[model samples]
Target: MYVTSNFTWHQLAQHVGGIQLQLEEKGFVKGDVLLAITPHSSFELILVYLACIEQGVICALVPELTTLDLDKRIQTSGAKAVFLCPNTSLTLDGALEIDFALEQGLETQNYSEQNLTSLIFTSGSTGEPKLSPTACITI
Candidate 1:
């Protein structure tokens, strides 16, 4: 499937706000871990990442989409939920289906520079994937 977007900055912000609300309403709270298995180049993936950031939820952007890879990620991240690609038919336990159509909003959160934001994993050429936790650093 092809991914394209024509959203302006204002529209993007609105979408992000809506996603944040969606996440909050779904019982996700600060420090909760989420696995984003959405397609790497998709706009929905971008929204998930931003919403998690604003909500102070730790998100791991999974690099691979295979079932085995996903299972490994879910296990290692201890994710509360998993975000899949829009057209995905895979049924995973704890999968969170997001509605980008939301317009409700929530207040932005203040995050510390040391706050764990995301987890980056290696390709595991040596063995099991190695994790690199990324922090929210404000310049």
Candidate 2:
């Protein structure tokens, strides 16, 4: 069951900062891609997403991906790492698994909409899935 909890603004900001620190420690820098393959969504995932944005790392969120699917994503996106929920039983090879706790910290960076921030895969009517990247730019 998904349990909802209340979080103050301060808590959220700190969590995001902690996540950013973790990402940096793991050698993930701006323009690097991270593939998150988990069956379910949780608060941690949201924090990671925010952290990636703050750090200028592109995050690709995948739901319940199989090994083959995971391989395709890695190849297409050139993801430097994969993130799994701490409680998950899945294991991956040839990719760094990032597991970090959200703690207290703060590090702010400028984010431009012109730079790619996230990636998604879209299936068309009659072909292989295509990668769709998102940026912050209005145009």
Candidate 3:
């Protein structure tokens, strides 16, 4: 169950579906990484993740930092696209952008699973930062 300041599960599912269609239509086939840079306070962040997963895309929900290291992470992620709020000035050439303005739900699906679905960067408060990728092991 997700509890946002003023959000519902239907809203989440609708947003997720729209994002899924947006990514797939942009040629985000299996095994592509989708970068998401947004504050944790944003409820749409969760929708972005769920959509990417449905499309078999790797969702790299990086932390919000104003450092060159962010560039390095985006580069390392090899993201085919990035999703965030519309008003933000975030830009990445050759990567598809999905904005909040297009949050209306769309029905689409092409699910695929890889050994890795996400790559996390920890809070530097603990340390500089670490790349801890979660690998899915199928037995």
Best by TM-score: 2
Worst 10 residues of 3 by lDDT: 130-139
Better of 1 and 3 by lDDT: 1
- Number of the candidate with higher lDDT, 1 or 2: 1
Per-candidate TM-scores read 0.82, 0.82, 0.67
User: How much does candidate 1 score in TM-score?
Assistant: 0.82
* Residue 33 error, candidate 1, Å: 1.0
Q: How much is the lDDT of residue 3 in candidate 3?
A: 41
lDDT of 1 at 9: 76
lDDT of 3 by residue, 19-81 (tens): 787777788876788777766645567667777777777778775656586677777777676
RMSD of 2: 2.8
**Model 1 score (lDDT):** 0.77
- What candidate 3 gets wrong by more than 4 Å, as runs, is 1-11, 86-96, 99-108, 112-115, 122-130, 135-139
Model 1: runs farther than 4 Å from truth? 1-5, 87-89, 108-112, 123-125
Residue-level lDDT tens digits of model 2 in 1-139: 1336777888778778888888888888889999877677776777788888888999888776677877777888889888875445678765554444456564557467776878988768855557899987732
Poorest lDDT segment (10 consecutive residues) of candidate 2: 93-102
